[model samples]
Target: MNKIKLVLALVIFISFTALKTKDDDFVKRSFDAATPLYTSLLNLTGDNFKNYPHSFLPNGTVKYYQIDEWTGGFWPGSLWYIYEFTREEKWKIAALKWTNSLESNQFNDKHHDIGFMMYCSYGNALRFDNNPKYQQILVQSAKTLTKRYSPIVGSIQSWNQRKSKGDINTWEYPVIMDNMMNLELLFYASKVTKDDTYKNIAIKHAEQTMKNHLRTDYGSYHVINYDPKTGKVLHKQTLQGFSDESNWARGQAWGIYGFTTTYRETKDKRFLKTAVKMADFFLDHPNLPADGIPYWDFNVGQAGYKPDWNFDPNRFKTTPRDASAAAIASSAMLELSTFLNGKQKEKYYNAAVKMLKSLSTDQYLNTDKANPYFLLKHSTGNLPSGREIDVPLIYADYYFLEGLLRYQKLKK
Candidate 1:
């Protein structure tokens, strides 16, 4: 009996060791893959730092965007993550060069995505280096962002009203679920400046978003239009989902990430509870794939979820899955797990592990040298607009690296 028990114990030890080695190998592989991919991107973009790698086109060519675009920061942010993972000086030099290129956007208040632009870049810089210069840039960016906030609307404006392609401008003051992400800049500024104004605005915006943007089931609307003068909700709609009422996968992921950050910064139970609900809603949805990736929108093929404007029943099977959303949610869930205990924490952590595993596979990870600059594939940017239908996105790579780093830290 003693000999049998010893053999069983040895088997368990070997199994655990193999699992640990496998997990570590995944992180190393991801870092190894990213190092060369980004190195190639830096060489391709060569000296013209203003143009950032955005995505791959359907023709398999790399698409670049100017620094002012919302996704510009993600490249630099990914560099920072690579730096953190590898501790290589070359990545640090590259990250600083790419990050400093966007310093001029500290004054850009045209959109709420300034947070996505500046925070993801300079914010990571601050995290890794703790430079006073990065802090100043972030504080100024937060100040600029505050200009978009209205006392009546109680939220930051996401986009300026504009006409495009013969479409009339009907939205007076539109706030999006994406705006929740910008509040982090404000929260950081308040902490650094020791002024309550920034934090106050962030809290109010979060409160209003919780009040208006969330459904009874905790699914988020992509956009919420408000009357600029009276604070009345004029319309609840979507600019990127299958339907105005559908749960856009990336939007849900954004809500989960944003609220998790909010709860981390403020330690507010309400935000914590809301984050949990949003995560649960996404994870528990029947339409979510078994591999943990979700379709571009949860209601794309479902009955009663078709868009009233452009319905296409034939597009059901071809609906692209968003690996970006899975990456973002995985990163968020890893953090959210730290705040819980017992089975809830285990559930979130295990789900995050599942997502990371799925994303690391060749099915999702970009293994083809034909498009080696980008990381993950099959991310749908804007399906209704017929843009970037199925391609590798910069932010997808950023969040995927982030999720891996977060997972690595938790495992340690």
Candidate 2:
């Protein structure tokens, strides 16, 4: 009788497990269509964005043009991530070519984006091979970043004199919302080099952001005004969003990811709590489209009178389908979900699954059987240049792969 009871229990367990696996497999099938689309982008871009290069201007040029400033470097990093997943030599060769191109830009002290510079290039290379030079490059980049920290503000300024001609304009000081996403590189540098200074600076920058960058309701602004001398938060403004007062979709997404990362590093409940709050705000906002993707700006479809003119073909509106935001937010959701236990974890897990499904099936995904770039419709570099409106964006491809990898790992 004991043997029979044991056998019966085993059978029940196996049967129940199979049913859950079947259900999970069914849900994962939705990603099947998107997987190849991502793989195709890796193929077409050819490791270094060579095949579908950043387009040239009407003057017929072919230099390293970018869609936007904040994440243009992320393009190569994205390719590296795909290579990490696929382990294809083609991706590696492309990544090497792109990293080679970035050499001249490194240590130039032009921009405050060491994360984009080191994380994708040297960071990826170092991970694969214990190369001393890559470590040197990352250390040099970190030092350059450290120099940007203001004693007053305790944060690295985003724009530099290269843009302002040694003016030290207040507009250039203080961390932009996007800088939070890149701070991880510095934190990583600290761990690899066994240096506390890098970690300290990175944390200080985040603390400054918490005090100044985030708004009353936890909706963050894109830019903050700082007194360069005192490092004071003078004012906060929303440059690219609908209004200085209105919420920007991408900014919210950045908050969701950045704060969560900060919390992971420090284990500070405030950062974790802040991340959950922001994530909740993003998921709960009525402005979000039914499909889980968001408009470029929250005020795009407000209940007021229509705009005097519809979106101009020549001029891209500040508000439109921002697939990039959705992709980033999806990755953040996975991270946030994994950290939580029990019911909270399950809720975020389901939401992330939903977002990924939406992204897979959404009309914006350019799954044109013939088109090489899977993520064709993405908006980027929206403010400075009106180019690449709702078109294939390289970063979109990058984040989609990241989110997929996160989901795949969660299942295990």
Candidate 3:
């Protein structure tokens, strides 16, 4: 019995030492990889308002600007997040310049992604700066967001000019799963302005997402149709991924993070429950690779379809999985882990650490200085023309930094 006890003690010590060694090695590698990225990011920020276009380019040349794309939020948001982490004055300068360029969009009479486009940039800037002028910008942006609330739908319309597309009017006020995330701005506006309308709007939107976007098993679809006239859910589908019923990896990530954020703001049992469901779906999905990274589409393994035979030459036929999803999930898991206790927290923290460690070593972390960008080999804007196919993407880098910061904060 003494011999057996001694053997068990030895095994436990070995396991503990191995775990500690792995964690220490990961911290060293992550810090080393981020150093050059941190320096280059500083230089990029120092170039000031004149050099950067509306958004940052991977190669540091911003000759072209994509004004209407969803990616517009990432640059300034990234700058703001980076500044918060690094406390570098140069990052603030770059972010302020980007924020200053969005005066018209904040007050635009239209209502499509004002939360995503304006709040993430200007609102975050206000959070970082605490300047009255930035506060005013955020307030106006919030009012604009409040105006988007539709009485018919009890939720904000996700896009505009949907009916003007003639026969394509079948898409009725589509409230995507992605929109669940945008509700954060509305919830914040409620806190800032002491207004119940903003809070109500955010909760109503989340309830709608729960009713429409989520499946019985908690897997969520990307897009859902709402009756613009009656506010009823018409259908739910995966617009960007394999099919209407198939899971999109990133969409699941959005649901995981979005629902968790909703829980954070509301402390509502429903939101927390939904978050757990989504978390379980994400971690238990067999489609994910052993390394914790996921394919661009979760249904790719099951989808017996081919890309259009006349596919564009620029787009690769093969799917290069997205590193951004892993980054985003890692960050979200850290946040979600904090909200849980005991075994749940341990499981989530362990999963998050493993995913991040995998990302740190995978093709995602491009330490090559000639490239300049830290996180590479991402698949953003991969659909349609296949704009950014298996290349270094700015958002991937942004999320990687954000994830690292979140992980570091959790450790401390």
The residue pairs found clashing in candidate 2 are 68-381, 152-231, 153-231, 376-391, 376-392
Which is the better candidate, 1 or 2, if ranked by TM-score?
1
Give candidate 2 misplaced runs (Cα > 4 Å).
1-72, 161-174, 301-319, 369-371, 374-376, 380-387
Is candidate 2 or 3 superior in TM-score? 3
Candidate order by TM-score, highest to lowest? Answer: 1, 3, 2
Could you tell me the C-alpha RMSD of candidate 2 in Å? 5.0
lDDT of the structure predicted as candidate 3: 0.70
lDDT of 2 by residue, 48-106 (tens): 53223442233433224442333445556665766676677866766666665565444
TM-scores for the candidates: 0.95, 0.80, 0.82
- Write the residue-wise lDDT of candidate 3 on 1-412 in tens digits: 9999999999999998898777756645765665566457556555453332232345655323355555456667777876786677877887787777666666754655666667768877877777777666666767787776787787777766353212334777777777776788778778888887878888988887888788898887887778878888776656666556767777888888888889999999899889888888888888878888877766664646333223343455656687777777777888999999999998878888888888777466665553554444555444433355455555565666667777877876
In terms of lDDT, which candidate is stronger, 2 or 3?
3
After superposing candidate 1 on the true structure, give the runs of residues whose Cα lies further than 4 Å from its correct spot.
1-15, 163-169, 315-317
Candidate 1 residue pairs that clash: none
Candidate 2 has an lDDT of 0.68
